[model samples]
Target: MSTFQERYAASVMNTFGPPKLVLVKGEGAHVWDVDGNEYVDLLGGIAVNALGHGHPALVEAVSAQLQTLGHVSNFFTTPQQVELAEKLLELIGADAGGGKVFFTNSGTEANEAAFKLTRRTGRTHVVVAEQSFHGRTMGALALTSKEAYRAPFEPLPGDVTFVPFGDVDALAAAVTDRTAAILLEPIQGEAGVNVLPDGFLATARAIADEHGALLWLDEVQSGMGRTGEWFAHLPSGVTPDVVTVAKGLGGGFPIGACIALGPAGELLQPGNHGTTFGGNPVACAAALAVIRTIEEQDLLEHVSVLGQKLRDGLVADPRVTEVRGEGLLIGLDLAEERSAEVAAAALKSGFIINNATPQRIRLAPPLVLTDDDAKAFLAAWPAILDEAF
Candidate 1:
């Protein structure tokens, strides 16, 4: 093993298994390992590196903020922190009616804050969708439905129910007046980019309203222009009471937000929850840079156009049975259960992909990925599939 790999194994926890490569440098959508091998990064740090690696805008923003003032603690807020909060509210369309934001260091912390906020509504039960992945923390884990992740962590917080995803009847039956919130992800990223059925989000919104419960959409993996929109649930025209976002928010910096709208915004009072490094100046500055770059570069339009092209090209091969998801967050099913083999083959051929399941391949490349890079991958895809299959 390489020196770095051996050192990593000795020092780091094994929660994520072994490191795939000892990466040394990156630019745009490509990365180079210590051995000097170049490869296109299709996963984009699991959808967190929105601007890709070492983008000038992100680097400069973080550097400038750190040089000025870094962490001020939650007792006092910095201008960057307030500006980012306002920008998030503006993007979420909550500025008009006014909203509140609680910052965290990651998606899991954001969800944890929102989870606690739901308890203030005097309802303990929460209705969540099956196959949903909120986070690994105890509070967030209670909302996740995967058996394997929850089995070992028994005695989790109670009063949580899981309904089949996209099943309107099941959702309607599961929610009641006693429910505190209805949490769902418009695009189920961990479950192989499973998009919600048409009108499913609208139905969820209605159910929450009828039962007087909050509608919380966890947009951690699909927000921040990942689905060609600010948030994936925007197109549904269903305004959620609470939204949790992280992943691509900071373009690589650690930042997350739990935004509550209207009356739901007042649920978490002073001293309800707090975090030390959640909305530090540097993190907020990094997020602001990501948002500005996306707007200036018009990456949303680019993502929409290129995503369609990549999806069309990927399905051309007969081995690909189906393709799902939006923008750069794409997932495909193979004719056989060889996704792991396919991903390994892709890496060997100078590409990086994710095996979301035994038969599912997920691609969440950087939004800044160029047309030439995509074309190169398309050209090499057939051979990669052949070697794997």
Candidate 2:
């Protein structure tokens, strides 16, 4: 092992196993390791590096904002904070004019804030989906359905139920008038990039409306142009009561937000929630740069076009059983459970991917990933699989 890897193992916790590489530099869709080897970063920090690494806009924004006003207590708000909230609300939807935003340092905190806000509705029950991933925090973990993740952290905040994903009937049956909210991911990221069944979100919106329960969508992994849209649910024409976004929101700057729409916006009053660095100027500035870059460079359209190309090229391989998801967020199933081997092979061949499941490989490349980079990966797809399988 390299010295950095050895040091990391000795210093860092084993929650994520061990380090993959001691990356030292990055530019756009590429990165270099400590060994001076280069790679195409297909994971994009698990869909967070919207603007990619060392983006001039992101660097400049963070630098300028830090120089201007690094941080202040929530007692005083900064222009970047308010501007970011407004911009996020606008991107989610125009009807979000009355939407309220609560910023946090990460996706978990965003979900935690939303979880607490649900309790303010005077209801205790929350309906969630099976195989969903919210966060590792206690409140978010309770909302998540994985037994492995929840078992170790027992006695989590109670009154949360999970139903089979894509099964509207099970979801409706699980929800009731006592339900304070129904939390869901527009696209299940950690569960192998599983997209919800057709009209499943519409069904969720209907169910929430039937019981007067708040509908919350966790866009932590799929938002911020990852799915070729601002928010995945926007295409369905279903407006959620609460939307939690992180990951790519700051383009790797570490910021998140829990946005509440309509009357749900008034659920969390002042003093009910607090965060010291939730909307720090530097983070907000970085987020603004990402948003501006996406718009100015038209990365959304690029993601849509390039995603189709990649998906088509990938499925052309007979070894691929099926491909799921949209835009840069893609997952492919193999004919056999060789995902780990495939990931290893990809790394050896100067590419980065994720083994989201035993038989599944996921890719969430940077939105700024160039056409040539994507095309090169596709051209190498057959060789990579052949070498792996």
Candidate 3:
């Protein structure tokens, strides 16, 4: 093992098993390891690096904000904080509809805050989908449906029901007057980028309305132009009562938000939930810069065009049985359960990818990934598969 790897094993928690590489530097959609090995960052820090590595806008914003006013208590608010909240509302189309935002440092914290917001409705039951991944927090874990993640954390905050994903009938049957909220990810990124079936969101909206349950969409991994839109659920035209956003929100900075729309916005009385470093000026400024860059660079359109090309190119290989997801949040299933091998092969070929499952490979490259880099990956893909299979 290398010096850093040995040090990481000794000092860092072994939660992620082992370190893949000791990355030393990054720029654009590429990174360099300690040994000076260059690689295309196809994973993009699991969809968090929207503007890609070492983005000037994100760096400048965070640096400038830190120099100006780094940290502030929730008792006070800054221009950056207020502006980011407003911008999120505008992007989510909740500006005129009356919405409120509670900031957090990560997607898990945002989900935790949203979970508490649901309890304020005086209902403990929340209906979620099978194969959903909310977060690792106890409350968020309860909302997440994976047994592997929840088994050890038993006796979690209860009354969360898991229904078959994209099944309108199962959703309607699962939710009742006791249901506080219905949580789902439009595109299940962690579960190999599973897209929701057509009309599912609209039906979910109707069901939530019928039961007076808040419809909360977890946009943590799929939001912020990752899916060619501001949010993955936007195309459905189903305005959810709550939306959780993070990941690409701050480009590569740590930031997340729990946005409640309409009357649900007022559900959480001030003291019910809070965070210390959630809405700090630096993080807010970073997020604003990310949003601004996405707009100025016309990244949404770029993501759409490039994503389609990637999807088409990936499915061209017979070894790839199926492809899923939207924009840059892509997933493909191999003819065999060789996803791990494929990921290793990709890394060997100077690319980074993820194995969401034994058969599923997920790719969430930076929104600013250059066409040249993509072409190179496409050219290498067939060989990568050959090595894996």
- Candidate closest to the true structure, highest lDDT: 1
Candidate 2: where are CA atoms >4 Å away?
Answer: none
* Deviation of model 1 at 261, angstroms: 0.8
**267-315: candidate 2 lDDT, tens digit per residue:** 9987899999999989999999999999999999999999999999999
TM-score each candidate: 0.99, 0.99, 0.99
Per-residue lDDT of model 3, residues 9-65, tens digit only: 999999998899999999999999999999999999999999999999998998888
lDDT of 1: 0.95
After superposition on all CA atoms, what RMSD does each candidate show versus the true structure? 0.8, 0.9, 0.7
Check candidate 3 and list the clashing pairs.
none
Residue pairs clashing, model 1: none
lDDT of each: 0.95, 0.93, 0.94
Off by over 4 Å in 1: 95-97
- What is the lDDT, from 0 to 100, of the residue 292 in candidate 1? 99
lDDT of 1 by residue, 258-339 (tens): 9999999999998888898999999999999999999999999999989999999999999999999999999999999999
lDDT of 1 at 122: 94
Candidate 3 yields a Cα-based lDDT of 0.94
State the displacement of the C-alpha of residue 136, model 1, in Å, after optimal TM-score superposition: 0.4
